[model samples]
Target chain A: METKDIYREIINEHNLHPSHHGEISNPTYEMDGVNPSCGDKIKLQFKVDDSGIIEDAVFSGSGCAVSQASCDIMLDLVIGKSREESERITEAFMRMIKGEASDEELEILEEAEALADIAHMPARVKCAVLGWRTMEKIFKENRQ
Target chain B: MTNIFKNDFEILHDDKYIYFDNAATTQRPKQVINAVSEFYRTINSNPLRGLYKWSVKSTAAYENARSKVAEFIGAEDSSEIIFTRNSTESINLIAHSWGLSNIKEGDNITVTILEHHSNLLPWQMVSRVTGASLTFIECSSDGEISDEEILNKIPSNTKLVSAAEISNVLGVRLPIEKISKRAHEVGAVMVVDGAQSAPHKPVDVKALGADFFVFSGHKVMAPMGIGVLYGKLSLLESMPPFLLGGEMIESVSRYDAVFAPVPEKFEAGTVNAAGAVGLAAAIDYVENIGFDIISQREEKLCRLMIEGIKTIPFTKYFGSRIPETHSGIVTFNIEGCHPHDVSSILDTENICIRAGQHCAQPLHEHLGIPASARASMYFYNDESEVERFLEALKKVRSWLGYGN
Candidate 1:
């Protein structure tokens, strides 16, 4: 894939002006994900309501465009999802990043399909999956 | 302009990519590649294990390589050279053998803060296991480690002083001779990590006053899995065997074993005979090119890169501003674009560069940067490549959507 295709308008927009690019106040769950090799770091914050539906999700950190934008886009997709639905979507996003998600899985992934070319760029795969991995870890550790 | 020596390297013959990551590893010349292939085809037997014709030839080739390395590094005796897998294994050998037996509680080990992880971590492990303190010799933001800092930091009870001759990240040369003098006065062994310096310049272990000098073969255009460790004869003889097994032992009974002498005592198991032959060929190739020409070409390329970066806005390079101090490495970052993005953008132009902490996280932490991008040139890299690199680097921010 050409560099332009990977850094498309949507990816650049999300990277430059991410809508959920801040901390959630009084967050119910907070976790930091780090890619040790490249030094990419993300602090994931979430506010899940009493019914286990994620009311709010945001992130703050320093990283490359792919990592930062991937996190912002991921939080946008999972904010209104229930704990179970978010988990399933996180799994699908991971699969999409790896280029293994089926047609139905890709449909469920929404805007995250923009990063499907990450599979061709193996070096940036970790950047594309940093948010989903962190969200998965947050749910796995803080079991409902 | 074309690199006069580029055609000698098969990988660089094609204009596929401009390789500027020589600090990580170098591409082997055809001479070295052919030498390795010749060794494998002619004599593939275990060196020191058999008495047949091919076995003797293999043993001769291995020992000849040892002699070449000793002569190349100006060691007094060939027996002082020990062949290992790489510089990491060589440093680990020192930590495990000499450090475990000699260093004790209340002692301190001094290393420069600019060290690559190979030189730093072994000392940390030694400090932890032996109850010794680990201290660092600090450098300035410009990558200068002053003589006063070295003097004050090495404690009176210091058992060893280890430092890199040239930093892999900053590309600054340390004062190995002065550090060696201080360590000697304090009764400490001076160890120099020559992985960076040996490839770009001439190194004499005796002139540097190093008790132990270690460097990797791959970084110097030799094949991987072969490294040279030069120790003072007296020190190598005194230290115990690092890896215990077949070739290193003179005799092995059910419960008792007498180890071989000097170099062999340290190199256990089957050695990389083909790798040694290839390294010898690489040494010959470097000698043919001569350090005078190598330094001249590298200095010119380094100056071009530093001067070019100055013209580009929002780009700053680490280390001393002087190009001579940087050897051939320039680690920099664009203000608005991340280092990974910069490297990826350069990748679109088929330009190769290094991006990350470079196995020196402590140095990165000290410098207050998370990571950096590095473009390290060798003699084979010409001025045109530097121009190409800088041109691509200038567009990195714009490609990432940062406006002019």
Candidate 2:
């Protein structure tokens, strides 16, 4: 698919059935991500087992369809992964979003690689990263 | 309103250009552009520092611009006008100098709920630094605050009342004269953020009884990185200097330094001389056209937009509908569509409008909305452009699947 096609696809998928579009009933960690420039906000929460593995994650917020849907897709990507592995996934995602990834790094992105085209839209880059950044903060604090 | 000089502005070439984002910035007139260009071509020299001929000419041009701005705003003396980067830095200068010097522990400063973050955040930071308390006078449903509400919030220790003369988001023209009178009665100095007002109408700082007035030049069809800070000479003399550099000092010893006069003391270091000249030319352009006529033209456009937008179903408008009591800003949101999406659709038509919180997030929170789309007008905008905007907005509504 062309870059615009991929972007349109991501926008369409997120708008139709947003992932992690609801709150987590009981979770170990929660954090709010706010993009002050445009007033986009997202709240992410995760449930971790005693062994420090990510059991589940969810998010809720009011923003552009891009941001809300990005959070939804981000939740699906990090679930069922270990805390360390999730952090690595977030770092890899940032590289892809910023368009700084190598060919090998592109392979690592796997399913989330559809969002690499967002790098061209500078204004919407923050929208694509809001969810991943929030998850990174939650895991960073919980790990320590 | 005349077309004799219309061709002078490059942005006016295409009649199809719908520039509704005037509150953000305006297109420079030919005279202002020529003045800036002439500075680099003919008289390119630093002012106040060098005694050479080019320097003298540059200094004279800069000072002449200051005098013109002082007269334009009805300041008592040209010496009272201080130059800064923009309204943000101008307000910051007051917060650091006058605010710190006057406001003490337990001192109260009252502001209105409709202030731009430029006017609100400076006082908030001042309160945090000085231990003084900051209180916001609530705005009405129409975005107007009454004199009674202002009086009720004025405590004995209220040091200042900083307000926006015209709200960038609400398009509501505040009763600054009445508010200033009430503030003075309680011994609080009144500061007006004229960033939105100065561009739309004639501003008389003396007539408004404001102790300090600040506005950015870019919003007035001048260049960016230049702004004016008008203060009473007494107040400017009493406050500490905002920045320390070469030009703002009278003499510097090993240990202590004597500062220059009021305006010079506030204007530290090399100023934006070219930008100041361009600003003066902008003022000259507006004056030649007459503010009353300019304001009248804008009011007509505002009414046209209001009527046009109201006809669209599910279009909820915010702010004052009264023409006389409003600026040129029109903020609204469709029921189902987000402001960003509306902005994207409008961008397709080349009809520029601002979307999102407009740097007034707390006000958005107060209004119980996440964000809004604002269509701010200027004198250059006309009824036909507003019609085009309304047409585009209708298309945006349907495309967003709003209003079945």
Query: What digit string (tens of lDDT, one per residue) describes model 1 on residues B287-349?
Result: 999999888998999999999999999999999888988879999988867788788888889
Query: What are the chain A TM-scores for all the models, listed individually?
Result: 0.95, 0.89
Local lDDT at B5 for model 1:
89
Q: Model 2 in CAPRI terms: which quality?
A: acceptable
Candidate 2 residue B252 C-alpha distance from true site, Å: 1.9
Give the alpha carbon lDDT tens digit for every residue of B341-399 in model 2: 67766776778899899988888888888899999887777777888899888876555
Candidate 1 runs further than 4 Å off: none
- In candidate 2, the residue pairs with backbone N, CA or C atoms under 3 Å apart (3 or more residues apart, or in different chains) clash, namely A19-A72
Return the interface RMSD of the candidates, in order shown, one decimal each.
1.2, 3.5
What TM-score between 0 and 1 does chain B of candidate 2 receive? 0.97
